[model samples]
Every structure is written in C-alpha cells, then in structure tokens.
Target chain A: MITVTGTFTVKKNKIEEFQTGTLELQNASLNTDKGCIEYKFHQQQDAPENFFVYEIWDEMASLELHGASQHFNKFSKLLEGNLDKELDIRIYNTI
Target chain B: MITVTGTFTVKKNKIEEFQTGTLELQNASLNTDKGCIEYKFHQQQDAPENFFVYEIWDEMASLELHGASQHFNKFSKLLEGNLDKELDIRIYNTI
Candidate 1:
C-alpha cells in the first residue's frame, strides 16, 4: 500500500471554507475511487490553521486517479490563493 | 485505529544522522510496541531536509505507551536542538 500525507497552512479566516470543501472531496474519493483504503482530514489541535490529509491507497495508480478526480480538482480550486505555502505532500510505501 | 502525522524540518547537514537514528527508533517501535500497527518514515521528494513520520495505532493507550518507551526517549534526545523547528504532530481518528 501507499500512504500519502499532505500539510496545508490555510489562511486563518478560511478554515471553515477549507473544511467544508475537504470533507466533500474526502467523501467523494472514498465513495467513488477504487483502492482508496483511507482518506481523512485533520486540523492540528494546537494550531487551528494547520491542516493535514492522511490517505492510504492500494497502489500508485489509485493515488494518481485520486489526484485527477473531479472532487480533487474542485477542492484545489477552492484552495487556490488561500494557503500560506504550497501544499507539502509526501508519499511513502507502507512497510 | 488512530493515525499520527509528524513533520520535522531537519538541518541540512544532519540528514544522514537523523535518518540513522530514526530507522533504529522505527524498528524498535514496530517490533516491540504492542499496538503499533504502522510506523514509517518518509523524506519529502522535493525537499530533502523535511521529513515526515506516519503512524497508526490500535488505541490511545498503546500510542501513549509507545511515546514513553525507551527507544522514544533515545530518539527524543537525539532530536534535541537538531531541528529547524519544533516537531509538528497531529493526531486523528481513522476514517
């Protein structure tokens, strides 16, 4: 399996907006994408503006498909110009 | 299951040392910790000095024990003053 972790620094005021869109994207990915084992969004306990998405996929193809999904594109558009930095994402092979 | 994601920004020159210590810590946690379902370290592809550790545990008690283990203490000491910033850790319920 492949695991994906993405860290985002959302503007303080856009937290509610980001969460709403992320929940929709997450639901779509899990419900519609094959091999999407897990996909969840989280807010840092201490830092409200810091967000993370942790995902598990059966393989690289599934992950790539997730990136290109309609939900993902819409989510990306929602995030445009609303971040402190570009998304910091890392993909790793599960041990 | 519970998921954990930690981001660490390591000094450029300490990459090798950090990875070595981290590998030992990871091996110990998985091999010895009772409920450590997954523990894997990943280096960001675009940024060499940035590292992430993704973990899953069976329960909160198990995670707490893992945190207080000998290997964890060793790892903590190894990380003292060696990072660019304090470790950023977030915990979330698995979906």
Candidate 2:
C-alpha cells in the first residue's frame, strides 16, 4: 500500500473555499474512486489556516488515477489563489 | 481525537539503527500505549533515508502521556546522533 500526506497553508480569507474544495475531493475519492482505502482532511488545532491530508491507497496506480480524476481536477481549480504556497506533498510505503 | 505526522531524516550510515529504534517505538506505542488508536512507520520510496510516522490518539491528554512514556524516552535516546536533523512534527484534528 502507499501512503500520501499533503500539507497546505490556506489564505486567511479563503478558508471556506479551501475547506469546501478539499471535502469534495476527499469525499469523491473515497466514494467514487477505486482502491482508495482511506481519504480524509484535517485542520491544525493551533493554526486554523494550516491543513493536512492523510490518504491511503492500495497501490501507486490507484493514487495516480485519483490525481487525474475529474473531481480532483475540479478541486484543484477551485483552490486557485487560495493557498499560501504549493501543497507540500510526500508519498511513502510501509517500512 | 488527534492525528500526528512526524518526518525524520536519518544520517547516511544510520538507516539500520534508525529502523530498529523506530520499529521498537512503533510497536510499543500500538501495543502498549493507552488511547493510541494507530501507530505506523513508513519510508519514502524515492528517499530511503526519509521516514514518516503516522499516529492517532483518542485525545490531547493521551498524546501528552505518550510523549512522556518510558518506551518513548528510550526510543529518543536510541535515536540520538542517528538523525540528520530534529524530527519535524505536525499535529492536527479532524475538520
């Protein structure tokens, strides 16, 4: 299995938009995408603008597909100019 | 509940030692720590020296307890001089 972690810092004014976009993408991935073992969105307790995504996919191909999915693409556009920086992404395999 | 993500980079020659120490900590956290719902370690596939730890705790107090546990202290000692830098840790709550 592959694990994916994404760190995002949202613009203070764009929290609502970011949250909506993230939830849509997360929900679509889990309910519509295949091999999506787990997908969830989180917000830092001490830093409201800071967010994280923790996802588990059965394999790399599944993760690739998820990225190219329509919902994913739409969500990306919805987040334009809404973040402080490019999403800091990391991928890993169980040790 | 709380979610924690930790990023660690091992020294070039310390991979073996880091792995052994990390596994010991991971196992102890999952098997013995109270309110620890999940604990697992991962290695970045493209960067073998990079490691990630994913953990879930029932509450803030439970997580605090984990930081002071004997196993955690022992694991900390074992990791000294093995890491390239301080572990980068991020904690979050579900949104």
Candidate 3:
C-alpha cells in the first residue's frame, strides 16, 4: 500500500475557502476512484492555517493514476492563488 | 504494512502539554522499535483541540506488540486525566 501525507498552509484568511475547495476535490476523488483506500483531511490545533491530507492507495500504480486524474489536476490548479506556502507532500510505502 | 490512524481530543487548555508528552513518547518508540515505519502527530486547523496520530507499522503483530510495550502502556495511563475524550483509533491494512 502507498500512503501520501501532505501538509498545506493556506493563506491567512482563506483557510475556510481552501478547505471547502480541497474537501470537494478529495471527496470527488474518493467517491470515483477504485484504488483509494482512505483520504482524510486534518486541521492543526495550534495552527489554524495548517492543513493535512492523508491518503492511502492500493499500490504505487494506483497512486500514479490518482495523480493523473482530473480531480487531482483540478486540485493542483485550485491551489495556485489560495496557498500561502507550497504543499509539503510525503509518500510512504508500507514496509 | 499496517497503518493506525488516531484522532485524539485534548482537554481545553492542554493541547500544548499533550503534544509535548505524545511527541516524546512517539520519538522514543520510533527510536527503539524496528517495526515502526512512521509515527506522526497532527493538529487540526479548524479544530484547535483536535489532534491526530498517524502510525505505520510493518505488520499487525508489530502493532499488537506496540500496544503491549511499556511506552504505549505509559501513554495509555497518562491519558487518564488529560484527555477530554477517548482516543479514536482506526487501523488500515495495505491492500
């Protein structure tokens, strides 16, 4: 299984808007994709502008498919003007 | 690979304290255990009281072992007076 963990920092006042947009993209991916095991978003307690995205996939190929999908592309494009910092993405392979 | 994701709610004013204690425990586990792939803590953006623990292990047996280990037991006991709610834990097996 392949897991992708992402840490994102939204623009100071645009946190809610960013979350709404991102959640839609995530849910769309989850509902339509066959390989997605889990996709969850988390907000930081001490840092209101910080967000985390945790995703689990069946395999590396499935993850690659996800990256190529339209929803992911849309998510990437959507972040263009809304993010305060680049997304911090980490991929993990189950040992 | 086995992934255990946990969502924990710290008491109203204990977020910082909880984070400090939990991070120490997690670091200790990571340093000592060979089966641990990743053990991370996340705090939610919108929810300041919400904290998430994301852990990946080599297998279920390792996770079970972790549960029985001294550090985990100590962590469990330490939550007695500090937590506002029970730890929400979810386990995922790589497909």
What docking grade does candidate 1 earn? acceptable
lDDT tens digits, residue span A41-84, model 1? 88765676778888889998998888898999999998899998
The CA lDDT at B50 in model 3 is: 70
List per-candidate RMSD values in Å: 3.6, 1.1, 12.1
Best by lDDT: 2
Winner on lDDT (1 vs 3): 1
| Runs off by more than 4 Å, candidate 2 | none
lDDT of 3 by residue, A10-66 (tens): 888887776787788779879988799988776665566777778888887888888
Number of clashing residue pairs, candidate 3: 7
Question: Which is the winner by lDDT between candidate 2 and candidate 3?
Answer: 2
lDDT for model 3, on a 0 to 1 scale? 0.76
Instruction: List candidate 1 segments past 4 Å from native.
Output: A1-3, A9-23, A30-38, A45-50, A56-65, A77-95
lDDT of prediction 2: 0.88
Check candidate 1 and list the clashing pairs: none
Q: List, residue by residue over B4-65, the lDDT tens digit for candidate 1.
A: 88778889899889889888989999999999998988776566677788888999899999
User: Model 2: what TM-score?
Assistant: 0.96
TM-score of 3: 0.54
Predictions' DockQ, in order: 0.30, 0.82, 0.05
Ranking by lDDT: 2, 1, 3
